[model samples]
Target: MMSWSHHLIITPILLPMATAALLLLIDERNRTTKALISLVSILLLAMNAVVLFRIESGPNDFENVYLLGNWAAPFGIVLVIDGLSALMLLLASLLAVASHVFALARWHAVGAHYHSLFQLLLVGVNGAFLTGDLFNLFVFFEVMLAASYGLLLHGTGTLRVKAGMHYIAVNLVAALFFLIGVSLIYGTAGTLNMADLALRMPQMEPDRLMLMEAGAGVLGVAFLIKVGMWPLCFWLPGAYSAASAPVAGMFAILSKVGIYVILRLTMLLFGSGPSAGFGADVLLFGGIATLVFGTIGVLASQALGRLAGYSVLVSSGTLLMVLGINDGIVSSGALLYLVSSTLTIGAFFMLIELVERGQDAGANVLAVTMEAYGDGEEHDMAEGEGVTMPGTMAILGVCFAACGILLSGLPPLSGFIAKFAMLSAMMGTGSIGTTPGAAVWTLIVLVIFSGIAALIAMTRAGIRTFWGSLEGTVPRVLVVEVVPVMFLLSLTLLLTIEAGPVMRYMDATIRTLANPAAYIDAVRNAVVIEGWGPGTGAKAGGSL
Candidate 1:
């Protein structure tokens, strides 16, 4: 009999997948039905998260694998949900719910197929988190990418279509590389199961180890391409900025998937030791370069959308750099920072869309400032024509300011806490006389300096756009506009309140990561199945 823990692992993925199917049969105009269905699925997924969290929090030591049709491991399809997978699933579910709520007001603007694609995207994300096999991860990647193709260009505008095409092209190439890498690993290891592969990797001959590392390196490149680190990140800002608001929020989760995979497989397969040189350096140096480059882009970008997009790049780089640090403390801090930065930045992106909507309603950002300054609407107008006022720019300004402080790493905000954790970890490492080399020190310096620069840019832009001068028209604000921003901000605050618990969770996860043998042991002892081929049999694939 399948365990209840297995059900928890499958529910989040299944809920969205099943919901997408049901939603497809419903009429496009039946917003009420569509919403109710979505809500139900979201609730179910949320419940699954709560259950999985409870399981992980217990002293029982959870690592449940569900085999489709009771076929057992190796040959059969499997879904493995461990602490890492559960945490990611919970985060993805929370974001999905928030994004769905935000879409309610904007759905009309987004047109048909919007909700469908969104659900499909969630399914892909959930499946990616749950799948225990390598090829299945690729399958989920394709599923998400196809939905993104539709969602990215939903409105069919020229700019959006062009950007979407570029996004699709780049990812398609990356996907192909991912496939090639997976094929190579399967051929060499003779098994595609992740846990099994992890158990077998360390025993491989030196030449075979080189071959495996090469394949893994190729796979890492594909993920790095997705994560928007340095050179591979060129397509991100323009593409994300051009996409719809909900799409942009979805993309926020998308980039993180790459890093999630890297963190997972790197620790699981390659072992979290100093010997993983090429991989570690690639992440470290590339991450530093990405941070500096993204900071420069953030400084130069004028549009709020583009700035938020670049901020994603910077955050990805920062997080990956922590991954490269290879220390439990640093990795733990990085994990915390990832959650903080994603929420903070995602909220900001949503807020930008709201601001743009308000501006479009004839209330200019400047009009909000003028209203506060007692300058008449006419005075705010550029010509003899009358300009309209938006009631919501002030609210948008406050949200923007909060996001700015969070992004810029100002005190008391959650962003500050994340960065402080990272810097403190790094300094602690240095103090232990391990002496992170000159390269690490250089990266540390550049990251700090670029952060300062990015802060200056955000301040200048926010002051000029929201508080500095009067503009022609103001955008009207709606409850829909404020709700998403509030939702994300509340999450940010929640992170602050439960810092101790969250940090402990991260540390526990880090400890698990630092010891891959525990994972291998769990899988090896879990079960033995009958009726599989020799290579795919119960025994672990040939040792690394």
Candidate 2:
């Protein structure tokens, strides 16, 4: 009997895959058919997310396991869903749907295969979130990367091709390292099942444990590269800034995948110190450095695209710092901040690109402003042609302000609430009291510095582009672009207003991640016990 749990894992993947395949079958010139297929896929994925959340709300942290071919435990392929996965899954689906809608307006402008590549990329992202095995994670990473190559270089322009090469090269290196690390881990542990590995990791010898730690460290570096943290992030701004609006929005979710994997691996395999362990320090200092570097980049950049890129870098840093703190309060705060930031930042980037596109700009302000002015005076240019309207600038201002509030930790925004949660958590440890501890001081400095830097940078960008007098005539913006920006801003505000409920839910989810025993037990119990199975397989309650 097929269960909802099974569907939960399969639906996010199948819906997108089926959509992409159906899109392929449609004539390349049939834009209407392609758009309809995209909408249906998104609706189905959203429905599946609702079902998964309902399941997760039930007792046992909403765990569901689907074992391939009736096989069980360490022997068979498994797809498991728990609290963290559920939250990420829902977020991915939401972003995917929103981005797809934003892309519809651009379909006529971009090539016909754009929709196909987009759906394929979705398949890879959804698969990454759903897969239970490490090797499968690598496979999905490649799938997403391959599709992204097409999307990033969709137009075959000189600048985009240059950026795409750098992007691909960096990722290819990361993938190689990832494969090596996974191979090493498998050779030493004899099991690739995440649950089984977690259970057995505590029993490994000290030297063997060191080897595992090294492997994990290498893997961590690879993911950090993907996340574009500090030294590893040089390729991001150029590559992302060069893509079209919809492509940039899709790319926003890409880096988060690396962070998601880090969150998963840290809590699952490394949090409890799986051998000779150094707890979260690796994440702490590295995170702080990333925050500083990203903030500096944001401050220094003259282009809107690069600024957005750097802000993403800062967001990644903040997330890592929260993870590094490792306290329940910190974890909950980090998770909330991540959810809030990802949506806002993703929306913000797309909005900027739309504004730029309307103005015939490419990340450079003076050039864009000139182009807008020139278009206004063109003899052949129609009154509304190649020009932005007043309503669009108003919409852009609102979106920019919302992004600024969320990214800069301002009040009445989820970013502020989430940062407060982290501060509260850090203070709970007496680190920031009358007697200041080193950890407390560190947290204090990090939060204050990061907040100030981000605020200044975002404020400058917002003021210059939105409020400042247009040195030249402004271009007319389209309705298709403004609607999505407003929608995403609304989501940020909603998260801020409902912080209490959101935090409570996030806390429950973080607690589950912090302690995986419940997750393991749930999956273990869900297995149907059939007397004895062949070749290393056993019933739910039996030994392998």
Candidate 3:
């Protein structure tokens, strides 16, 4: 029998896969049934993710792997569960449930098979996290990209379709980069399994190592695109801003997928290798540039959606810089920041639609136009258009303010704690001395300035949307539509409440990442068959 631990580890991927299949078989006309089924699957996936996290939380001595087709590591497909993967799985599932549930309020009906695509997207994301090798990672990456293409265009607007086309084209190029990179690495290293690659990273011939590093650099670009790094990130804001609110919320975690891969590979491939610190400078400087660019975008944003979109870039740039720092302390704080920012951005994405529902379709344009020119004639025409903010609008306003606080790294929230942890670690520890490098100081200044930019942008936008405008009205919001936003925000609040334990867990996870041997050994020694069956020699997909 497969171990119970293995079962839970595989549940995230397999459950969603199975759910998507079943959802596909269901007719689109039975929308309620499909919605309920998809929702239930996501809930179960969430529970399984939570359980896996709890399992990894205890002592984390070994990463658990389930080998498929009864083959051992480096030869067969395997699903591995560790602290980072578990945390990411939990985050993805939480975001999925929120986005999916919120979609049922109306967005689901806009597109056929929205439920199925949502589950398929989870299959890809969960698989990407769980897969033990580069081959499966590519497979899952494509799966995710394929599903996202559909979801990005879910509501079918001119904006969405146009954005989706560009999104697909860019990702296809990235996917091509991914394939070439993987092929190069496999050709040089003789294996596609990450652990096995790590085991050979330091001992490879000089020529092979060069090839591998080249491959790794190519691979990094593919993910850099996903993570919205500068130059490559130009398409991100427009695409994300054009996406429907629910889809945009779910897409928040998508950027983190790239961050996860980069972090994983950075440690496994270069932590203690001949190639140690190979791309550190690029990541550092690129991250700094990205942060600065994102801050400019944030401050210049006229629409709330674009502001939220730029915030994703800020989150990506920060984490990328953290990875470049390569310090366990900084990384731990980056993990916390990752969670807080993702939740905040997701909540903000959903809240934007709700908040904007009360305003005229061109209210953003009107506000910008008035600021740039004048509202001399337009304002008088709508003098009595404003209404008192009611309970629903008030709730949305509070959520919006919370999002701004979190995005700006304000006090009394997880965002503040996360930024404090990272900044302190960077300022206090400069590799070997008390004085940090110019790059470190640059990152610090950019982070602070970025926060201030977010604050200024959010305040200006909030004023236009709430106080400054005289044409706003109370939007009709459903309990379901509003609840998910609160749930996501509340989790950020909960992160604030449980900062100590969470940071401890992040530190432990960082420690696990610091040791690549644990992962290599776990994959190498994990049992394919728990015990030999006495029958016809058939069991478990031999499954993972």
Candidate 4:
């Protein structure tokens, strides 16, 4: 008999796995039944996530740690639920529900196993968020990538197939790096459990310590690839643009999965250990470069789909830069920004499909004409040719404006609030040494400039689609599709309304993360099975 606390921690993973398996048994033609099941599973997962969050946030000294089969930590599988994991679980659930609902309008039928793959993807993502050990994290990472490969090619166009193949090849290489890194860490640290590794890191010999750092560096590279960090992110825009709308919406959370792992490991393994500040410089500078790259991509993008893809890069880069700063205060604000930006980008991806539907053919022709000749007047002729639908343009216009505000960190929305919080936190850090450092100045300048670029790109795109191109045929958007976009945007509004409580929660989470003792203690003290002891089970180089 398991307690509610134990059940809640695993529900996000188990429920999805079970649901996906069940969906696989159902016929593809039973679309109604499949949709209902997926919706129910997502709703239940969201409810469970809320419960887990409340329990973690409550006044309790004991951590919400669960050991599978009653096995103790550092010896067997463990799942730990802290404020950060709870927040991520909640965010993943919300995005999952919205994407699923939006897919029911059309995308679900575009592929054979969309519903099953969607649930499996959630299983992977939620598992990654909750797992407390390194090996399991790798397992979940593979699960996620496997499902994402299918989702990326769901619609099955030539462009999608090519992009999907590229995406798969890149991730396969990353996965190889992940395995090598994990193997090296296990060999060096003598344990696969994160908490146990943290405990042992301070006591290791200098040679082994160097080996551990090398392993961690390799691991960091693997995660950076997933996060779309610079030089390794060439596949992102093309892959994202090729994906169907709902699938692309879900992909927004996928990059954050990498960011989450970096934050978790940075705090757990290195925050106060001998390796403290190990990768901070690389993350800091690399993040700034990634931000600059993303902003340039955003400014130069001609298509809304590509712009949404670049926007994901910008969000990832922003969080990475902040995490690189390595201040608890700034991290608290970055966490808020994480939630706001993920939602906004997900909504933006969904909205892009509807906004671009009316001018797809014209845009393609213009691209070809421009490429064939130096310049062309095709775009002028294509503009204002769309047919006007009474309420369609108005609804899309409002949603597009909301996405713009959120992306650009404009006033009154959650994006502005999040960026303001981060800026204030950074300023509170005061000048680095005697004068302000170049990184600090760069961060400030980029934040402002990125917003301006996003504003210009979104505004230009919006005018072309809504105001400038009224002569084109009106996009036929289903109510189901439109509602999900509204729901996502409305949640951003709710975040704005509930800014006080949310920020306080994020602040508390950061404090907990900064002090790693609590996390280590919880894992070390987790309940043990009857037969297992510290030295009795799988140790380093032994079968796990």
Candidate 5:
């Protein structure tokens, strides 16, 4: 029997799967029941995530891997948990909780099976994070994409439908690439188990090695598309901007799924051996280009929704660039940045709907145009012109400012700390790591410029929405809706307050990732309980 502690590895996937199934059976008319069930399930998953993080956060480097059907890795399926996956698990669950609560305000009822699809999306995300098998990674990828398809079209509108269609088409092609890539890997390595594949890489013949890299390159393309890489990401802004608030907020973490896979595979398989630096230049340059594009979009966007969407690209590009650098110290900061940016953006996405609720159609565009060409005449003061800002407007303004500060990497926030950590580490100002002159400096400039662009864009939008529109009617916001935004923003605030401990945790995660031996050995040495078969129902436990 597996230890109860070890069983925690599968709960993130299992809990959501069960919740989604249960939710499906519940009548959609009883949406309150469905919502409560889904929310409670996610909240429990959040608790599970906390426990898993604590389990992995200790001094020990030994990771937990639960072998399926009482069979070991390189043969049977396994769910593995280490510091990174635990962190990601926590991030995903917490984001889900916030988005779900936000949806309950009204968005859930507008769509059919919203709760079910949402839970299924969680299943796919957690499964992808946990699985050690490459084939299952593809399975989870499809599951995630599939659920996302329904969620993207949840509150269907013409713009949303069009965006959803494009999203589906793009991901379908990417899925094909994912299949081809995985098949090639299995064909050459004779295993779909990631650890086993990593172990096999050193012994592969040169021809087989070349083929494997080709496969990995193809695989990278699929994830890059998901990561919203330039040229491949044209569909992203539209889809993201078109989705309803809660779904869009949840979608904030979707790109990170691709980043996680790329990091896991790149570091495990290609981080060393014959292909140590094989595809670094491509990702490095590609990441830079992506930042450039995302920044341009940020500055050029007049609509708040589209700006938030482009901001996702900026986040993806930053992480990819850091990963391409391949330094553990820099990666630690990137991890922090990932958490901060995701939470900030999630809050921003939810907040955008609330802020825009009171604005006139084309107000964003008109606001931008008026700024550029100037409104011809000044308006005479009306009777209520000097009225103070409403309580709701004040709250929204504060949240908006918090988001702007976080996204811009401004001072005293988690975003600033995360960016500072990465930059200092990259520049060799930190305790470890060194940077090259031209290329790294170029990346450094782009990173800084992206932050500045975010600042400019966010500031302009803020002025338009809060300052200029202060006299406008306050949008009717429910406590349920705004609290979720506050919840996400507050977490970022907590991240700032606890930066040292979080980064220390991040350091441990990067260390574990650096030592691929730890992961490979954990899988290889995992044992089934003695005298215990798959269905024996023994009360014993296996060593992890």
Candidate 6:
């Protein structure tokens, strides 16, 4: 029998896969049953993720790496769990639980097979996080993209279909790029396993190293596109804005998948190897440009949906820039920001739909009127009467303010804590010549500017939605819908309350990622059955 320790590494992937398959066989009419199954499955996944996090935090062990079919490293598939993967697993599971519960309010019934697609998406994400090989990463990427395609078009609408089509087309091109890059890397390195590739990279010939670098560049482009890096991310805002609330909420984690891969590969293959500084300059500049663009987008957005979408871009850009900095202290802080920002953005997306339900009618009228006739005089957009719910406006206002505080890096929230940590790390580097470098200044300026932009945009949106008009209709938000939003926000508060432990964990995770010796050893030293091959007489899981 496999040890529970080994099982934990695979459960994040297998549990979701099994649940998704089972969900597929169930009838769509059985919504209650499906919701229960999805809820339970995700809860279990979350519990398992927490267990993994605790285990990874406690000890250094050999059982963290599991070789499928008892095949050796660089041969069979492997799933490795460490601090980063465990943390991602926990975050993803938390988001999944919140998104699924919120979907139960109404979005799940918006299309057939919603629960199945959701579970499959989780499977893909967890697999991507855990996979020890590049090829399996690609496989999981495809799985994730496939599920997202369906989720994006979940609700039948002209806008959703058009946006989904664009989303699909863009990703298909990215996927092709992914395949080409993978092919080149494999051809050059003669191995698809990440740890083995890292081991082999320094031994490569000059020409093959160039080829690998070229492949990495192509792969970087694909990941950058997914992460909404500027210029390549024209498709992101519209696609995200067009998606249903629950789908959009889940999508907050989707982009991070690309970011995760980049972080993983960069640290694993080039942290201290021959290609240590490869692509660092590109990441630095590209991230800066993306941040500028996202800030501009945030300032220009007129609708909450588009604004929320742009906020995602801003978050992506911030993380990308920090990664480019390549300092472990900054990276640890970025990880904290990553978790805080993702949860806030996901909650914001769900909240946007509810907040906009009442405003759509008036906004539509204003838009049509504006298109037909010019603004002849100064007119208050808030002149209309608003409908009031007893406590909805207050609750929504508070949540909206929380999101703003988090997104804008304001104080008394996790976002503030995260940004402060990052800023502190940058200033503490001690590498500055009496004056900070241009890059340091640029980062500091952009961080402050981005926060201000988010504050302005969120303030405008909240004012317009909650307090603008006294003549609007009360939005019919269900308790189920509101609970999930509160849950996500509460988690952010918890992150603030427990900032010390969380920051320490992030610091430890970054250290482990920076020093890949333990990771490499775990993979290299995993036990394998002798004569292991397809159809061979080697029984699985036996000692050599």
Provide the overall lDDT of each model, using Cα atoms, as 2-decimal numbers. Answer: 0.76, 0.75, 0.88, 0.87, 0.89, 0.87
lDDT (Cα, tens digit) per residue for candidate 6, span 1-544: 3465667788999998999999889999999999999999999999999998988777544277777877777888988888898889999999999899999998999789999999999989999999999899999999999999999999888999999999999999999999999999999999999989999999999999999989988988888899999889899999999999989999999889989999999898878767997888877888889889999999988788889898888988888888888988889889999999999999999998888876655674475355469657755558564355568877887899999999999999999999988887777643322445778788988998999999998887676667654346778889999888999999999999999999889988888888877688778777664565442433223110
Q: What are the per-residue Cα lDDT tens digits for candidate 3 across 71-101?
A: 7767778788888999999999999989999
Model 5 agreement with the true structure over 81-167: per-residue lDDT tens digits: 888899999999999999999999999999899999999999999999999998999999999999999999998579999999999
Q: Highest lDDT among the candidates is held by which one?
A: 5
Query: Least accurate stretch of 10 residues (summed lDDT) in model 1?
Result: 535-544
Best by TM-score: 5
Which portions of model 3 miss their true places by more than 4 Å?
60-63, 372-387, 429-433, 530-544
Candidate 4: residue 317 lDDT (0-100): 86
Q: Evaluate residue 487 in candidate 5 and report its C-alpha lDDT on the 0 to 100 scale.
A: 98
- Model 1 residue runs over 4 Å out of place are 3-5, 61-63, 272-275, 358-391, 429-436, 528-544
Global CA lDDT computed for model 6:
0.87
User: How close is every model to the real structure, measured as TM-score?
Assistant: 0.89, 0.89, 0.94, 0.92, 0.96, 0.93
Which tens-of-lDDT digit does each residue in 1-544 have in candidate 4? 3344566787899999999999999999999899999999999999998888887677764346777766677887988888999999999999998999999988898779899999999999999999999999999999999999999999867999999999999999999999999999999988999989999999999999999999999998999999999988899999998999999999999999999999999998889767998899888888888899999999998788899999988998899899888987778779989999999989989998988876754664464355558463455557676555568888999999999999999999999999988887676543222333677778978988999999999987887777656346688989999998999999999999999999889989988888888888788876553445443342211101
lDDT of 1 by residue, 67-110 (tens): 55445456666777667877888888777777777777755345
Clashing pairs in 5: none
User: Which of 1 and 3 is the better model by TM-score?
Assistant: 3
True lDDT of residue 412, candidate 4: 98
- Alpha-carbon error at 420 in model 5, in Å? 0.6
